[model samples]
Target: MLKKFAKQTLVAVSLAVSIPVFAASYTIGTGSQSGTYYPLGGILAKIWSENIDDFDMRAEVTAASVENTIKVATGKQLVGIAQGNVVLQANEGVKPFPRKMDVSVLFALYPNAVQFMVPADSDIHSISDLKGKRISLGAPGSGTRVSSVNILSTLGINESDVKPQSLNYTATTNALANGQIDAGVIVGSLGVGAITELALTRNIRILSFSEDDMQKIIAANPSYQPLEAPAETYKNVPAFTTPAVWNVLVVNKNMPQEQAYEMTKVAFDNMKKIRQVVGVTKFTTLENMNKLSGIALHPGAQQYLDEQMKK
Candidate 1:
């Protein structure tokens, strides 16, 4: 009887030791391989995976916000980088979100200035002025595509009005410089390398939003905020002023609250260091974070904020 009891105990111990413990890992869906968001996402993945033992993390090159939100909603992605206003629209079943999506905001990341580029001598001067011209709206299912359509729709312009080319930022820049496309639209902070490089080698103008355009977009969506990108943001360009937008970090609703909580803490704790990462300058502060995130904060992120408040 004693030998049998010992054997049963040993078998139970062996079973426990042999069964694998599942370790949680998260994937952040960013943008195209060549874009600023990808590298920034990789930086986040490194920080989360290396410093935080609670969860494993990595960044994936994806179609950006519009698709990223859908991915998060459907459980294909654990986290996503999204445009702020777009996130609100997604949750409300507007624009890119054909149905309401099930993702929550972790925090606002950075300003995504609405940058319009045209040849130095082009006749295109404003949003409405681009009528009958060739433009790159970005690849289908991308955040840039959704935002471009939204802004153009507000201006009473449709895909038919311009030769809309679906291309990524790198492709758009090349097309613009080569005179293949008259204009390209980008959404990100000023000083992003692609824009800076384009500006340095060519005469490019960043279009401004007229008061009418601002009013129309804001009236259509209240989450839209008026922003300004100062001049000389890139080499050889004089200080220029224009209206802009922002981006947010989102997480799946089904993500483990414990992992989300720790990830958020790690993000805020290391946000200062995150700024040093490429294309992350505008996302370095809690204030900016609060201003740009549109969705309801996740419980995990809220917990971190709560702890911050107590301090």
Candidate 2:
């Protein structure tokens, strides 16, 4: 009986040694729970956890783009989702960014269409109309707010000219629905939850940028690319052309090349799975990788892209 018990213990030990253990669980800092970044981060984390060999990634709710830049640069997060313009600002030590950040781009996600929305029946019809009207420009110091200010100023509407309300996407939408605010800015991917919810019962119109308006916005900041939101993107919303900033995935530049390469490859390989849930993620492809500017791609990411060239 003693020999048989010893034999079973030895077999159990061998089996345990043979099984692969998850090396580490990393955190990907994403935006608020109601925004696009959060869900996209969640989807990527789930895909990585399942597809990667002995690795797991979890998503953490964050204040979004601006905070994500600092988190990844400070080593507080392994990965993060941030707006492309914010990334450029962080790289260049622009306002809201104290100094140049040390980071690397992993992939370009999607565009955050800077959607200026107001009640459909409201007389507001142009960016200039926002003057003296209450506007919610995301949370204070957020990427969305940065875009709002940049665009407004480029279009000749200064912050002092408008009542700027610093609120999150959810609160901004709620405020608009409740008539507490005159206009709101939602800088997010198509079908952002807050806007989707508000559009369900409230008649909201997404203000679009005219051709000249877009040209000026982009000239001031090349990070702002123009995109059109399709009518089907949200209920009662029409297809409108607007200036957008690309959303991107990033990692600390210090991450080892092999790890970064592996992570980048894994994400692109499994991007189809991501697209299944979020159709907009279809932009997360090798073809769209050039969307980023002023930020260097990690060596590992470049290596992976090179490898794809061979394929």
Candidate 3:
């Protein structure tokens, strides 16, 4: 009986040793829970975890673009989602970033439309009217804040001229609904949940940028492009034009090229599944990959793009 028990113990040890373990684990830094970045990161994580052999991934909620860039640059996280303009600024050592960050883009994901929202009955009419008004320019270290600053500067409005409030999308919406803030800027894809929810309870006006204003903004910051919010995107709201920036997926430059290549492949292969989770399919395409300018591509990403071009 002792020999038989010993034999069974030896067999269990051997089986445990033979079982395969995950080769590596990675974390993806995403934006707030209410935004697109978090849900999109979850989808990508699912795809990578399932398709990449012996690999594991986790998506972490972060403060969005600027913070994500800093984390990925410092190697605190393996990958992150950030706006193209923020990535460019980080690479160039611009404000909010202490020094240049060595990061590379995996691919362009989607366009983040800058939505300036206020109560319908508010007297504020245009970007100029925002002067002297209490405005929530988005949370600190967020892409929305960076874009808002540019827009204000281009319009010749300084930060001191307006009462600036730092708040996230959800908080900004709540503040606006409660009349704590005169207006707020939200940077996200069309039909953002927070903005939609605010529209449901309160009539909101989406401020539009004039043609010259758009041109001035683009001239001051080439990262921004003109985009339009379609009619009926928000309840009872009409179409309006605004400045937009592309959101990109980035990884540390130190990440292995082969791993990045595999990740890119897996992302494209599971694009359909990703779309089922987030309705921003129109922006996630091979052709849109070219839209990712100003940011350098990871070697693995470049290799994948080259292969696609050859095909």
Candidate 4:
């Protein structure tokens, strides 16, 4: 009888321990199938699943920044990626935000450039010159598309003036290479593999906005920063520079504080590894993560930020 009672007690204790194990399951909302967001989110998901205690996590490829932000805001996804400009706009109830989204910053994940690529033989020299040409503004609902619209708006070009093609990076690249499209716009980290590959495989030119035009763009959107896209960022791309913005990682307002804290720590702790995965520099620092958050930092992420600040 004594032995049987001990066995029952052990079984009860085991069940109790297993209860908390299944309590948490998380999903990360990434971007389209081929874009940078999907792969980056996948890496983060793997890191979280591997290191996070008693948590199950996975990455899902969605429409991209705008869609990902909505998913996080509405709790459809616990975590997601958003462009810095998009996050700021959404937080302030701008454009697609409709209502002020209660999303919080997990980290300023990376610096994404406003890469405007044109055919090697195209006469379009600046944003204004593309007024009458067929340009792939990026796929519908993507951050790239939104950025393209903003750039066009800066040049007094709206949807009505130019032919805007809604296509993904792969499709846009192919189209531009085959003379099917005159230009393609992409928002990606500095070393964009697709853009680099396209430049190497065929004749391509990186578009640049005039100084006055760049200033106009900056005035319109403060989140955009002037970045120099060095010649080495691509092959035979010439020593060209352009102004662009950054991308941010965001979480739903209701994400667990502890989970957010862990995620924040994981990002900073393994940032070296992340840099290898994504060509992000400068945005991963502790100071920038705290000072330049695209949206409100989660309470748990705040805790980590506080710790980092202290050190």
Candidate 5:
């Protein structure tokens, strides 16, 4: 009886040793609370936490794309949502970033439309009309500010040509309503909440880019593509042309391959459900998945894509 009991105890120890223990936690950096990235990040975190065994994940609210990229690159966060142009610039050590970041792309999320708004009665009819008027480019470190600056520079409109105010989406809306700003540059998916709210009370106009202006913008930054804000997106507004950049999911280069693979798999598998929360999911297709602007794809994401292609 003593021999049998010792044998059973040894078997239990061996069994325990064979069982795999996995305890991993990660954070996804997203944009402001009022923006789509924040809520989308929450949905992804929930999906990952629920589906991945022994995984703990959370989403952090950040200052938007540029900040998200830097955080992810520096390992302050495991993953982040960033604009494609900004990601490319970060990878190349551009103005906003001090040096090249070791980051990899997971996938493209959506196109961020550059929506320039003015009060309906404002005299600013086109991008050119903003000269000598007050314009609210987005907050200093935000992707919107970079895009706005690029657009303005391409049009030969120097900083000295207009009075520029650094404001966020909500602040820009309030300023427009209060007549504190003549125009504001907001970058987001169609029918952004802030713009919707501002349009409900104040008559708003979305500026369109002329063909020449579009060419100039494209020439300056190939990452930007022509996009249109569909008619009826806002009250009494018509479809108008603008420039857009894709928002991508990025991870630090050091993220484990297995973890990144599983993360990508979970995201693509739940694409339909994710779309219910993030309208941008409509853009997250296999085609978009293959498009990595300037940034390299994480090896794990590439492995998953290869496996997907086989099926």
Candidate 6:
């Protein structure tokens, strides 16, 4: 890691330029401050800023996936991190998105597990038991909410049946710790910062979907695969079954092919920093580039990934 950082730093220092001081700017849309997206976006931005000259690149916090997808499509943001399922919906002209979003992929990010957690001593033992409880479904326009709604809808629960709280990961964990909510669902990587802190103070339960129901959900949504939250993720949290979806890096389809290629190349070449972001990020390598379906890959990104495959 130090070697790569030094190499990248030297490259930045060695570059000669006659370009304008304020060359251009770009943004990476990320999630709330408490979640993995925020930090991971920071790392990605760092990679770009260090390697790609004449651009002021930054990662800004926002409502995750759904918001990121729309921003990138509309050219409000240059690049974003979004859930695979949400991006597919945008690609297919699905509701919540009025028209097909013109977007292109760079590569897969990581798998975000649907973490449905509750106070270990709470009486909400199952999804059906959550009907009357105050639950944090996730922030508005986040992929976490999408997964929460899908889980509830698949299990025959309506929003009206329960008191819903649209809180971000940090707020959700805070609410749970303070007894403001009975349960919360966070779609994030394992070893997620917020949950880890919560577990140190309060024993938590990682709830599982029933075996039969899980199979049914997967059959309908192929983008979501079966996942298990192991007992080691947090202090005294038991193992449980859940669903996970891949998070992909995306950009506007209008981005130049060469720019896209440069971004993709820089990312994989400096993947050590990305992997250090979180455990799931280790999957964000050349081998996992084409995992998402439906969404088109940027031509430049496709070319670079294809070249790697031939090696």
Q: Pick the candidate with the highest lDDT.
A: 3
lDDT of each model, Cα atoms only? 0.79, 0.88, 0.89, 0.80, 0.87, 0.88
Tens digits of lDDT, candidate 6, 1-311 = 99999999878776745334774788999998888999999988988888888867899999999999999999899999999988888888886689999987889988888988899999988888999899999999999998899878888898999999999999999999999999999998888888989999998898887888788788878898888777878899988888888999978888999999999999889988777765578888787788887666889999998898899
Q: Candidate 3 residues 1-311, lDDT tens each?
A: 99999999999999999997756888899888888889999989989999999888889988899989999999988899999999998988988788888888999989999999989998988899999999999999899999898789889999999999999988999999999999999999988788888888999989999999999998888988999888889998778999999999988888899988999989998898999998885688888875767777899988998899899
Runs of candidate 5 with Cα error greater than 4 angstroms are 1-23
Question: Which regions of candidate 6 fall more than 4 Å away from where they truly are?
Answer: 1-19
Error of 4 at 280 (Å): 2.1
TM-score of 2: 0.91
Q: What TM-score, computed on C-alpha atoms, does each candidate reach?
A: 0.89, 0.91, 0.93, 0.89, 0.90, 0.91
lDDT of 2 by residue, 110-203 (tens): 8888989999899998888889999998896578898999899999999999999999988999899999999999899878888899899999
How far residue 124's Cα lies from its native spot in candidate 5, in Å, is 0.4
lDDT of 5 at 117: 96
Instruction: State the TM-score for model 4.
Output: 0.89
Tens digit of per-residue lDDT, candidate 5, span 63-120 = 7878888988998888998788888988898888899888889988889999999988
Report the number of the highest-TM-score candidate: 3
For model 6, the local distance difference test gives 0.88
Clash pairs, candidate 6, are none
Worst 10-residue lDDT window for candidate 2 reads: 282-291
Candidate 2 Cα misplacement greater than 4 A, ranges: 1-22
The number of clashing residue pairs in each candidate reads: 3, 0, 0, 0, 0, 0
lDDT of 2: 0.88
